[model samples]
Target: MEQVTTVGIDLAKRVFALHGADGAGRAVLRRTLRRDQVMEAVAALPPCVIGMEAGSGAHEWARRFRTLGHTPKLMAAKFVAPYRRNGKNDGNDAEAICEAVSRPGMRFVPIKSLEQQALLSLHRVRQGFIAERTGTINRLRGLLTEFGVVLPLRSVIVRRDASKAAEALPGLARRAIDDLLAHLRVLDERIAAYDRELEAQARGCEPAQRLMKIRGVGTLSALAIVATVGDARDFKSGRQFAAWLGLTPRQHSSGGKSRLGHITKRGDAYLRCLLVQGARSVLHTATRHADRMSRWVQGVETRRGYHRALVAIASKNARIAWALLSRNEELRIE
Candidate 1:
């Protein structure tokens, strides 16, 4: 129970590996503790910086460790990857975590609060329901074609066609179509319910409120930002934040020369997707407006086509979002 300076924990389901280094950089403690004994074991030691990978149960353990007077840091797995030397095992990974956290230039993940996690959970559930509904619609469309019925392009039209087809269907096909429709209805209801829940949650958050001032951002984008970026202060700049969300063009450099390429697309896929989809809505509905971003997008569309413009606008939107986030104010889009 000496004064430890840095502690690296490799967490697992039933067992945990702890590697502790003393103030003098000596390997003073190495032990395997049961899941139940983890807190008790750490609590006995003096307060120190505890580094753990952003894995399952890490946040709960982080809260627990912080309560026990230790500073907890969540390290991204990718950041720790370079520290791995030779074979990768629990002990090696624990050592790598130690090495990674000890470095001065390592970036850390901000721990999300319960409310933020709740918002994210709602979005995930809604996404699943939407995917399910889409599958049901496609299946319905495919099945109707077998009976010489061609569905129209629109989803609503397909839905209506499916309903009418079900009514005129034979015994087995009717039952199958009925079951699919029922599931689709249930999914739609679930998605709507979650949207309401998220909207309510977003209303109370200041960052989300500020985000809604932008043209493209709505309840979903606002809530997604609150859920995804837990603390805006953790980011250095709006550009950095935007890049972190995969909203910036990537670069390729060699021999002191640099060339920019497509977006890196290396961070949270969900938030990036939400931002892009929100931007698409803007393109579809508000591109006629005389705003700078909208005008830029229109120009790109005239030259490169629609999707390319969409991505460019989405990246710009993310940058604007980061600016709004860092300043903690409503957007002043012009």
Candidate 2:
């Protein structure tokens, strides 16, 4: 006991490791608890700062701990790794988390609300469906090619010609092709349904609606950003927000010489992908519109070439999104 002031728990499925420190940062408690005993154990202790890595079940635990009068700090696993000493066991990990959470400059992850997690669930499932559909399409193409029926790379063309090509194949091969095409059709329907649901959600969400007004930010991109980034204000600046999404360049500096490389591509790969795709959309149609953003995009395209222009627009859009979400401001087309 010794009046615990801070604690860290290494989370797991069945067993957990706990480390506790007193006011003077001296280790006062170290133990393990089973899954069912965790809540009761923590409830017995006085309210204190609890820290854990941002991973599976971390948010739920954080939410629950808040109700028990405990302050929960969730840190990225990598940040906690350096603090760990000796072997990689639950006890050492918990101890490291205890040490890391007390650091004044250490960053913490924002706890996600149930509503936000729910919307993100939809995104994850929809992405899975899309990936499955892509694999199915590729399989269909590969199967057809083996039977001397060459189809173009386009899905639309495959949909049109697949049936005719299948009709000319041998009996079992034809049946197999038919089945895959049917499966593809089912996946398409499911994906479309998810798209409609997301569109409705975006329509109802004020933040998402505002985000959609930004060029190249469609329903999916807006919703993804909103759901993934719980509170934009957690970021000190738009540049920081962009850096969090791994849209900013990585640095390799030493001896006071500055060196910048490609994007670190470190955080939230899905969100980064969505923003980059939106940037590509902006780049393709920049010539059609005379708006300031379009003009700037065109200039970047000309000066930096296509690929760098994409990153420029993506990073810029990320910054604008941060401003919109954090400051509650409207987009100004100037």
Candidate 3:
């Protein structure tokens, strides 16, 4: 077989499929290996460019492959999907990855370090706890309404009123509500603990600390951005970074005409959400400040409307964040 110069791997829980191509892009080797044999197989091959989807265990594999003197590039599954020629199976997917990685214009996901992966795990767990608490709160509110007691939407009010209202309910109903309330309490405590942990992480991390200097950025947002965006330099500009976060408008153009719609909502939804929320906070207080950023935000709100202003601010913040991260500089609000 011709020397395999590029490889694409379809990673699965137990089985993995690999497609190898020579420098001329001719298929050279195709193989499937069990989980146990994957490492040895890759380690035995001559160092070359390897490509895989940025999902699940791909980062760790990329790190491992890099140690073996191979250039491992990870692409979003959506980007690889276009290259798929046949039915969606392991073999075709691997081939698509192989082709996608070789494209000069193809975008690649930055390989995250162990520290980044660890921090993201914390963020994920904290977010999960928060979601669970929200569900519990909603359930409690719904139950109370059935008993002719309507609770307020605010979590604090719900917690206070629900407990008092639960006391007046019948035996079984009260027990169920009480159990849910207990779970809510546990979730609240755990979420608080995670918040403190994230805050400490933000305080300790220089990049996150710089990010926190922005008007709307806080502990969680700062830390989340720092963790998710491994290397800001991977992006050529702040505008590119904002687009990556899906803060930019979606474009649909033809015949030399340009049409723009709502944000494409691509990339990490969680990160985009945090940015939007942060932007909202900035918009709320823009009136209180006379800074250049505040003025721009107010002008956008005046001309475009409220929600668009929020998105604009979020996009600007994302760009600012990229500049700070890439340049290793502090934010100087003017």
Candidate 4:
């Protein structure tokens, strides 16, 4: 088959599209394989560069391909989208991935190890629980409002006051709200358990421990950052790391002039949210500390509005995390 030099895979749950090309970029193979046949098919090909869009199961497949002496690369789906010549289909997507992987300047996502994936899984599950809990809280509040009972915004207060208010309501309403309150309690316990697990995991990770030394970074943020960005060295600089986190500004330029807009908000929304929330916590207490970081944060907050300051601090912390992880050094307060 002309000794395939490169292959691109369009991955799916049950079916996969494969495109193979030779040294001069001539198509040598185009085939589709079932999930079970993917590894068998790849093992039959000569060692070559394999490319796939960065998506679910891509990292595991990349690891498997590496074991078979093939070089695996994962590109952002958006980057490969530009290479598509025709309507979207598994075959055309495979071809586009093939073309995108061959580009000299193409950026690739780092393949995550099993441990990293496991940590991310924990974060994802915890986030889901949190969202569900919030929905439950809102529903409870709405139900209470319909019954002419107003509750405080704080969850603790709402839970307390709602339980008390339910006593005065009719039997059916009381029963329904009592059930929701019980569910909320269950969610609270689940969320707390997840937090404890993450804390234990962070304590065992030296890098995460080092990250926790930084101001505005707690166990969750530390573990999340370490797990999300496996190796900070993959990024050239902290700014690049922050950019990957979507903490940098979006750009619009024309005729040699540059315009900057709001943040790109491109990657890892959960991680970004954690960082921003941490930054907010820091800003709220910045006045209590006279450190350089606090002073800078206060200055930014005073000059620009609080929202902009919060984002700026979040980006700065992202950069700081990159520096600490890349250099294997502790954060020093100056």
TM-score of each: 0.91, 0.96, 0.98, 0.97
* Highest-TM-score candidate: 3
RMSD of each: 2.3, 1.3, 1.0, 1.3
Candidates by lDDT, descending order: 4, 2, 3, 1
Provide the lDDT at 25 for model 2: 97
Q: After superposition, how far is residue 165 of candidate 1 from its true place, in Å?
A: 2.2
Stretches of candidate 1 above 4 Å error?
145-153, 167-169, 285-287, 299-305
Assess candidate 2 and give its TM-score to the true structure. Answer: 0.96
Question: What TM-score would you give candidate 4 relative to the actual structure?
Answer: 0.97
lDDT string for model 2 (1-334, tens) is: 5899999999999999999999999999998999999999999889999999999999999999999999999999999999998899999999999999999999888889899999999999999999999898889999999988888889999898998989888999999999999999999999999999998999899999889988878898899989988899998999988888888899999999999999989778998998889999999999899988898999998898999999899899889999999999888867
How high is the lDDT of residue 119 in model 3? 96
Clashing pairs in 4: none
Per-residue lDDT of model 3, residues 67-103, tens digit only: 9999999999999999999999999999999999999
Instruction: Give candidate 4 misplaced runs (Cα > 4 Å).
Output: none
Better of 1 and 4 by TM-score: 4
lDDT: which is higher, 2 or 4? 4
**Model 2 stretches astray by more than 4 angstroms:** none
> Lowest summed-lDDT stretch of 10 residues in model 4?
151-160
